[model samples]
Target chain A: MDDRRVAVVVEDDEDIRELMVALLGQSGFEVHAAANGTDGVDAVKENDPVLVTVDLGLPDIDGYEVTRRVRRFTDAYVVMLTARNEEIDTLMGLDAGADDYLTKPFRPRELRARVEAMLRRPRVAQAPVGTQAPIPTSVPAVPEHGQGDTAGQAAGPTSAAAGSAAAAPSGPAGRTDGSSADARLVLNGLVLYPHVHHVEAEGRDVTLTPTEFVLLETLLRSGRVVRSKAELTRILRGDEPDAGTFVSESDERTVEVHVGNMRRKLGDDPRRPRWIETVRGIGYRAAGAAETSG
Target chain B: MTTAPVIDTDALGRLGEQLGDPEVLCGFIRRYEKMLGQRVERLHHALNTQDHDDWMDAVLSLKTSSAMAGAAALSQLAAELQDYLAKRPPDPVRWPVTDCLESVMAKLRHLARETARQLRLFLNRLSASPQLA
Candidate 1:
C-alpha cells in the first residue's frame, strides 16, 4: 500500500503551480497539480489528498466554489492562496470551507510552517463508529462522570448535568487515559463520538468539517465553560491552549469564522443558539439544554 | 537608464533553502522565465481591450509569480499598476486612462524583460557554482 501523504495544488499560474508542486514534493507529499478550478476539483476527487492549496482566482470556477465542492466528499485541509491580502478574502475562504489562507508573495518558510502545523493536527477517521472492530470487555469502561479537572462539569439546569455525564476530555488538555477515546458526549440532544469523528443531533447525523468537529467536541466537553477566542485559536493551531503561543488577532478572527460556519451548519442560531452560544466579549460556550429548550 | 536590481537574490536563496533542493529552485526559475512573456502579453491585451476582469487576473498573476521568483522590482511594479487600475475612475473624467496606461505598459514591458534576464543569469550562476548546486 502507498502510505505516502498526498497534496494537491490548485493554481492557475504555471509558475506558482510548479513552485507549489516542487515545495510540496520536497515536503514528502505526493503532489498533484491543476491549473484551473475544474481540473482542481477533479484532481482532488481522484487523489483524495490530505492537503490542498487553492488559488482564489482561477480561469473557470473560483476557489470558493471548488472548496465547497471538495468539502462534500472529503475533509482535506485546504489552504487558499490569494494575491490580495484583504480580510474579506480570508473570511470568504474560511466560510467556503478552507482551513487556512496565505496571501501571495508569502514567505516560503511561512508556508512550510503553516503546512506543518496543519498536518500535525489529527484528521477525522472516515469510517463510521459501528463498523469498527469491537473493544475487548477487559478494557476498563470510560467513567460516566469523569473525575479529571478537565472533565465536563455539570452546569446549567438538570438537562445540562445529564449531558455532562457523557462528556469526554476535550482535545489534549484533559485526556489522561486512552479510555476517553471511547467516550460519547451528549449536549442538548447533540451526540459526539470523539473516537470515530461522528456526530448526531436528535438522531440525525451531522456532517462537520474536521475543524468544526474539533471545535464542537471541545465546546461539548467544556460544558458551560467559556472558551476564549485566543484559546480556541491555539487549539485550532494544534497547540495546547495555554502553550504560551502568541495568538494574533487574525488567528482569533479565523476561529470566529470557523465557529460561525459551524453554527450555521449545526442550525444553531447565534441569537438563540441551541448548542453553541457566544458569550460576547469572551468567546463561545455550549448552550445548556434547558436554556435552549424554550 | 540602468534599472534597480530586478531580482532579490536573498529571497531566491531563502526559497531555495525552503525547497531544500537547488535543482527545484532552478526549475522554478526556468518556468518563471518561460511564462513571463505570455503573462505580459496577456496584461497588454487585457489593458488594450479594457477588460477589467482579465486585467486584474493578468496583473495579479504577474505580481504573484514575480514575487515568488524573487523578481522584486517587477512584482512591485505590478502591484502599483494593480492599485492604479483599481482606483481609476470608470468615466476617466479627471485622468486619461489610456495616456497613463501607455506609460505604465512600457514600464511593465521593460521590467518583465529585465526580470527574465536576471533570473536566467541567476540560474547560470547556480548551475556553475558547485557549492550552490
Candidate 2:
C-alpha cells in the first residue's frame, strides 16, 4: 500500500501550477496537477489527496465553487492561492470552505510555513461503519490546561490523554480500557471527541474543517473562559499561545471567520449561541450551561 | 530613471530551494517560457480585437503567471494593463487611443522578452553550477 501523502494543485497558470507541483513533490507528496476547476475537482475525486492547493481564478468554474464541491465528499485540506489580496477576497475564500489562504507573489517560505502549520493538526478520522459514534455526556477527563505547549502538542487522542494524566491525578474516572471518553468534551448537546477528531451536535454528526475542529475543541475545553482573537490566531498557527509571534489583523479576522463558520455548522446562532458565545471586545468561549439552559 | 528588475532572482532562488532539485527548477523555467509565449499571443489577439473580456482574462493570467515565475517587471506591467482595462468602458468607441494601446503592448512584449531571457540565463547558471548539478 502506498502510504505517501498525495496533493493536488488546481491552478490555471502553468507557472504557479508547476511550481506548486514541484514544491509538493519535493515535500514527499505524490503531486497531481489540473489547470481548470473542472479538471481540478475531477482530479481531487480520483486522487483523494490529503492536500489541495486551488487558485481563485479558473477557466470553467471558480475556486469557491470547487471548494464547496470538494467539501461535500472529503475533508482534504484546501488552500486558496489568489492574486487578489483584498480582505473581502480572503474572507470569501475562507467562508467558501478553504482551510487556508495565500495571496499571490507569496514567499515560498510563507507558503511552507502555512502548509506545515496546517499539517500539524490531526486529520479527521474516517467515518465509522454502521451507526454514528455515540456522544459522551460525562464530565471531560481532560481540561487541556496550560495556555501553550500542552494544547499545541495534543494533536492526537493518546497524546492529549497522556498529557492530561501526567498533569492531573488519575482518579477513578480514569479508564483502564483506554477509551476515548477521557478526551471527550461535552457541552449543551455538542460533543467533541478530541482523540478521534469528531464532533456531534444534537446527536447528528457535524463536519468541520480540521481548523474548525481544533478551534471548537479549544473553546469547549476552555469551558467558560474567553479566549482572545490573537491567542486563538496563535493557537491556529500552531504557535505557543504566549509566544511573541506577531498575529496580524488578517490572522485575527481569520479566527473570527473560522468561529463564525463553526457556529453556522453547529447550527448555533451567534445571538443565542448554545455552543459558542462572542465576548464583544474580547473573543469567544463556549456558552455556559446556565446561559444555554435558558 | 531607475528601472525595476525584469526578474526577481531572489524569488526564483527561493522557489528553486523549495523545489530542491535543480533539474526540476530548470524544467519549470522552460515550461514558463513556453506558457509565456502562448499568453503573450493571446494578449496580442485580445488587443487587436479589443475583446474586453478576453483582454481581462489574458492580462490576469499573465500577471499571475509572471509573478509566480519571478518576472517582476512583466507582472507589474500586466497589473497596470489589468487596472487600465478594468477602468475602460467595454464599448470599443469609448476605448483608449489605438496608439496608446499599441505602446502598452509594445512595452509588454519587450518586458516579456527580457524576463524570458533572464530566466534562461538563470537556468543556464544553475545547470552549470557544480554544487547544484
Candidate 3:
C-alpha cells in the first residue's frame, strides 16, 4: 500500500478540477476529484485525504456545508475556492471550518505553494480506526509575553517536538523554524499534538480547524517574538503570494478574522488573554515560551 | 464584420496547461455545448413562469460556465446581467450592463447566440492548428 499523502479536489468545473488534480499530483499526493458537495464530502470520508480544496458554488450543496460536514469527522487541511468579489464567501468558508480560501483564477503555482506551506506544520498520529479521539481539553490562559523563558525551555526544543511519542522526557515537540515534525508540544497544561493536529488546554482537547491549528502553532513556536500581521498573513497565504496577490491590509483582515474565531474556540478572553497576547499596532505573540529556540 | 473575439484561444490554452492537455478543453466545450441548451431551456421556462429565482439560476450558471470556458465577453455580460438583476438598483453601478431585466435577458439571448457561433469558429480554428490538434 502506498503511504503517500492523499488530496481531494471538490470542484464543479471539469477544467478546474483537472487543474487541481494535476497540481496535487506534482506535490506527491494521490489525488481524487469530485463534481459536487455531496460527492466531495463522500470522497473525503472514503480517502481520508490530508488536504482538500472545495469550490463555493457547488451544485448539490454549498461549500460551507461541505466543509462543516468534513470537519465533523476529519482534520484535513481544507482550502476553499472563492471568487474575488465575494468577501463573505471567504469569511464564511473559514468559519465553516476551512483552513484557507484560494481566490478563483489563481495561479496554479500559488495553489502548490500554499499546499506546501500547509503541509509544513506537521501532523499527529490518528486515533485507531472507528474510535473517536478523546474530547478536547479546555484552553488554558496563555502566559504573559517575555516572562516565560523557563516555561519555554522546560517545554524542550527541537527533539521534543519532533518525536511523536508523548511518552518522551519532555513535553510535546514543536520547532520554531517549522522544520521538525515531532508528535506533541506541551506548554505547561497547553498541549499541541502536531501529529494529529490536536490541541489541549487545561487537560481538555480543543477542536481547532486546520487553519486555526496552524496559526496557534505558529504563534506558540514563536513565543515572545512579536510576529507581525504581514508575517502571519504570509504564513496563512503560504510563502509567496507577496507581490502579485493583494496588499497586506487585506491579508491583515484574514488573519484578524481567523484569530478572532480561534480565540472564541479556545475561549480565551481577549481583554485578559491567558494564552495569546495582543500588541497594539503590531501583531500577536503567544504569551508562553519566551525563550523559544525551536 | 470585424468583431473582437468572444472566446480567447489563449485563455483556452491556459486552461489546457492547467489540465495538462487539450483534451479537457475540447471535452468541456462539448459538454458546455450540451449544457447550454438545457440552461437556455431553463431561461425560457423562467420567462414563461415569471420565476425570478429560476431566471437568476440560469443567468448565474451561464455566467460561471462561460467564465470557466474563458468566454470573456459572454462571461462579463452574463455576470453583469446577473448582478444587475440581483441588485435591481436605479442605476448600473458595479458593471456596465443595462438595469432592465428584459434588456439584460435580451442581451443574454444575443450573447448566447453569438457565443455559440464563436464557439463553432473556435472549434474550427483548434482543428486547423496542428499543435492543438
Candidate 4:
C-alpha cells in the first residue's frame, strides 16, 4: 500500500523497460514494469496504477490488445511507445484506447517532461474519493535528495510523497461552483464535472483516460470554435492552447484516434455524432456544449 | 569522407545515465551479445524452414534489441530486413533470402563490436566517478 502514485511500464525491450522503470521511479511513481503484454495486463490489474505506458509491439499480444483489456477495467492513462516507422499504428493504438503515444528512441528528458505534463492534469477518478491531496494537487513535486542535484541516486517518491495523506475530502483548489467538486459542464445528455475530472454519458459512467479527459475539457472550454490538431497537441504539451509550433501529422492522427475512442465511450457514432463533432481535417469540438463554471 | 557511425555514443551515454550504473549497462551488453547470436540463428532457422512468420518475429526482436543497445545503424538495417521479409513470395524459394540475411548479419557483427567498445568506455567512466562509488 504505497501511497505514492503508481506507474506501470509494459515494454518488451529490457533496455526500454529498465529505462522506464528508472525514469518513473525517480519521478515519484511507485513503478511496476513488464516485458510482454500478458504480464503487463497482470501488473496493471494487480497495481491499479494511475499511469501505464505500453509499447505498441509486445512479445505476447501487442500493446493494442493490452490497452483494450485495460480500458475494459481501469481508466489508467495508457501511453503507447511506438517505433518511428510505425506511425500508422498510432491510429490503431488510439482506436484500441491508448491515451497517448511516444515514438521510440525518445529522449529521456522529453519523456520526463511529457510525463510531468500528463501528471499535472488531475487524475480525479483514481483518487478514491474522500481524500484530499496537497497543493500542486495532480503532480507531486520532483524530489530533491540530500545530494545537491541529480548526482548518484535520485530521491524517488520522497520529496513528491511529502504531502500529508490524512486530509478528508478529494477536491481541487478553487471551485467557482462549490467546495465539494460540483463543477459541472453540460452538453445535452453528456455531463462533465470539471473539478473531479468526472464524466457521465447518458446516465452511465464513462471511463476516460487522462488525455481523453483533457481533450474533452479543452473542447468544452473552447465552445464551438474549431481547434486544429496542432492546437490540441500544443494543449497536451502544456503550451498555450492558441499557440502552436510545427505539429507532426502523426499528432493529428493521434487526436483522431483519441477522439474516436472518446466518441465510442460516449456511445456516439462518427457517422452522425451527437456529443463530439469532427471538423474534417481541422480538429474536434463538443456538440452543443453549455459551460456553467463558477 | 564520412564513415556512418556504427553506434550513437550520445544515445549510449544517455542510456548509461538512465541505467544509473555503468555495470548495469555492461550487463545489458553481455545479454545483447548472447541474444544476437540466438536471434540470428533463429532467423536462419526460420528462413531455412520457410517460416516467414517466425522470421519476421526474429528480425523484429533483433531490431528492437539493436535499438535498445544504441545500435541505430544496425537497427535501421534490421528494420529494412523486416520490411523485406514482410513481402512474402507466393512460392517459398530458397534463393536470395540467404543473401539478404547475410548482409544483415554482417551489419549486426559490426554493431556488436561497436556496442562492446561503447560499453567498455561507459564502464571506465563509472569507475572514475567518485559519486557513483
For each model, chain A TM-score?
Answer: 0.78, 0.75, 0.69, 0.68
In Å, residue B99's CA in model 4 sits off its true spot by 6.2
**Docking quality (DockQ) for each candidate:** 0.66, 0.54, 0.27, 0.26
Strongest candidate by lDDT: 1
A90-204 per-residue lDDT for model 3 (tens digits)? 7877888887778766665678877875665343333332323342233122211232111111111211222222312221123433322233555656777544455667765
* Candidate of highest TM-score: 1
- On DockQ, the leading prediction is 1
Candidate with more favorable, higher DockQ: 1 or 3 = 1
Q: CA lDDT of B110 in candidate 3?
A: 73
Docking class of 4: acceptable
Scored against the true structure, residue B54 in model 2 reaches a CA lDDT of 74
TM-score of chain B of each: 0.87, 0.87, 0.73, 0.70
Candidate 2 local lDDT, A1-294, one digit each (tens): 235577899998877788788777767788999999999989987877768899988888999988877765556678998877668888888877788999877766687788776665434333222213442444222222242111111222322123222322222111222343335567877877654455668976666666787788677757677888987877766566666789888888899998987787789999988889999988998796321110
Stretches off by above 4 angstroms in model 2 are: A1-3, A130-207, A243-246, A265-272, A289-294, B48-54, B87-94, B130-133
Q: Which stretches of candidate 4 lie over 4 Å from their true place?
A: A1-3, A124-176, A179-184, A193-207, A237-249, A264-273, A278-282, A291-294, B1-3, B14-31, B87-133
TM-score, structure 1 vs. true: 0.82
Interface RMSD of each: 1.1, 2.1, 4.0, 3.3
- Model 3 per-residue lDDT tens digits across residues B20-129: 54555566676665566666667666656656656665666666677667677777776665665568653332333234546555666676777777877777777787
Report the interface RMSD that candidate 3 achieves against the true structure, in angstroms. 4.0
